[model samples]
Target: MSRVDSNNERLMILSDVTKVYPMGDTQVEALRGVNLQIKSREFIAVLGPSGSGKSTIMHILGCLDTPTSGTYHLDGAAIQGLNPNELAEIRNRKIGFVFQSFHLLPRATACENVELPMVFAGINATDRKACAERVLDQVGLKERTRHLPNELSGGERQRVAIARALVNRPSILLADEPTGNLDSRSGAEILALFEELHTEGRTVILVTHDEMIASRAQRVIRILDGRIGQGSSDNHGRKE
Candidate 1:
């Protein structure tokens, strides 16, 4: 288990985190000394324009990439210097990621896609299958469990992806532009689902450029030019 403190108030922390990308003789800083803290069940939005480092933050939060410098503690464990395999293990065990593109298996059904995470965790066939079915139903896809990516509508496919993300019961649901490719109605539906998850005490961190979507969260952290800007939201929120 991660080294949770007695108070157990924080789920993740980043202290002066920085990420630099190699660009020939020069280096581009993607994240610049970012400091953030997330509690166990807070819903947050990391909002910024393209190239503003929100995506980099998302990658780091999801354990898809580590920062070039500084510290990150997720679920009370220090994650700054973990090896690739260790990072992969942490990702599989603690983070559930939903991306802009639904990266479902082209040949698999919805339940099969949802079961992929458990397969990596060495879950037995019977339990994994049953869990997949239950989560798919939770995401409002009970009737579409057998549908292939090509057979489902965009919204349904996104819901399947959400189901896949939830199958492992991760500590955090990290989404990157989850409704970016959907129509207004579909996007609203997906956002509603995110809100539902938040209401149920799940930790949700959404990275998006859409202000409307960001507004739905309880707190919003604005990133600008690879640095955190002023007036970031507190626990109390910014609006009525």
Candidate 2:
């Protein structure tokens, strides 16, 4: 959450990162010596299939999990050894997450759902409402602010979810399978919205199994069997 990168240059750095899980009598490696760097305003995609460890990378990038070994620096501050509370603060204040499921409160109105993050962060009701409304407008859901999740279409619900993610104005937008639940038309619309956000200078990191979806990003890093793949095979098989 602290802005250690005063030069405003790099946003994230990972060096020889690894993650291993204890599974009964055996150990499972989810990440293997991953090294990566992300600058502010970059749009990146972690492209992989199930069990390829892309999600683990996302979790580490979002500060939801720590690397089992190696270092991770965000905003130029080393984060590998931070406590859970510290990590939670970082996740809440610096990372905006979009999941395959819309993850909105079923009973809350769209505006209220978007306001939830700020509410937890102790923002006043007035400010939360205003910020939520503004982001909803940005995501093309201004008129549907009062609609509940069940009252809106699939695309509209996802828009509300995105509005919530943007309300924090976090340092990075990390999306995991963001378009997985939508139809092709709606998914394309969502991708366009993300493009618009990237244009506005937000750091966007998309994690998805679909190669076509990853192709939309400016850069793609493929993962396979818990390790970064060696590939000149860029998005959609286009050479970079």
Candidate 3:
């Protein structure tokens, strides 16, 4: 049987994208004329200052928000004007999210937290359990599957979050400040895991403000005042 990924076209495409938000009589442009493309297995870092629109770009790429203008294409599907349901479908099937806070339920065990998305997607009980367990194991949390969020260390909790993000086999992994809350050692471990995932041919977009961490990515995109800064590149190593 042919692998499903053999059919993958370009993973993502964005052209002249701009996102504007209206507040009272003023309009704030969160993203301005952003043009970008990401291939199937690239590791990219979106780097910028606090108000520089890195998060905005991540949201648009993850299908959580639509651009006010211009076009977006994900895995060959045009997403310019897709409605909420369509956007949700694309997010569920193609994008996985990892945030700095982990976002695990305080009362739920690690396995249960990892299984929530599959449950929402109507996966069978047995399949959900198996899938969650496998992913937790992948994130090195097999022994802590039964522990609740408060019982795990910071690193372990983030690992659980990563497991939850990976449970659905999504085509793209979006990590927003993934190591922000961890110490240097733990952050290093998480970065190593990202590199491992990249080596395994996953499309990983890491959003961060730290230059050291951003440098670890194969390509780095820096945004400033809602516009692309100098670091944006067409090829991984090419500036133009």
Candidate 4:
């Protein structure tokens, strides 16, 4: 896997990106010539209602899918032309994803769950455990490392998921409706954690439909009808 250059300021750029799916004889346009750019260490929120292409955009940005047309550049690398193996390599090395579903293995302990990514990366057992514990502690779940998913609260489980995502030290953190399954307080706590990560200089992209949730981000980019709507300025009031 190629390492993303730390000196590169533009972390992601999508120009005239579009995605289409064929259903029977009809074609569905999920994204319509979307254009977006995200710089390093920016906390951005992509907000849209259900079936509004937000999820599709997230998939493409996360390298889970490719654009049908146009270009996507990530950390100075052209992404749309990469093969499946190359895409997977980039996703594993440079992107961390936290979804609405905790997606934790029911049988695995918090430490084990967080170790899965490193496992796939071919890290040895000792290092994987150590890294997992360190990240779990970073997420404030140090004492619960031995606990299973069912034993942890919703927020704690989400924290474990976040810890898993961070275990690899990816260049970008992509979260899709991360707080959707938690209570209001839990959700707030998760958002706080995201903010803390952002302050630590991680590029965090949050995808959600909730205004209140989206408001927590430094910048909010609204999406509607498969296209980007007006976007708010960054926290410093500077437009990117």
The numbered model that scores best in lDDT is 4
> Cα RMSD for candidate 1?
3.5
Give the number of colliding residue pairs in candidate 2: 0
For candidate 1, list the clashing residue pairs, or say none.
none
RMSD (Cα, Å) for all candidates, in order, is: 3.5, 4.2, 4.3, 4.2
Question: Model 4 reaches what TM-score against the true structure?
Answer: 0.92
> Which lDDT values do the candidates have, in the order given?
0.90, 0.88, 0.88, 0.91
TM-score of each: 0.93, 0.91, 0.91, 0.92
Task: Give a tens-digit lDDT track for model 3, residues 29-133.
Answer: 999999887778878999998989999999999999999998999988899789999898888778889998888899999999999889878899999999999
For residues 95-186, what per-residue lDDT tens digits would candidate 2 score against the true structure?
89888889999999999999998987899999999999999999889899998899998889888988888888886999999999999999
Roughly what TM-score does model 2 have, to 2 decimal places? 0.91
lDDT of 1 at 231: 62
**Residue by residue across 22-133, what tens digits does model 1's lDDT show?**
9999999999999998888888999999999999999998899998999999988999889999999988988888888888998999999999999999999999999999
lDDT by residue (tens digit), candidate 4, 85-184: 9998888888999989899999999999999989889999999999999999999998999999999999999999999999999979999999999999
User: Which wins on TM-score, candidate 1 or candidate 4?
Assistant: 1
Report the candidate with higher TM-score, 1 versus 3.
1
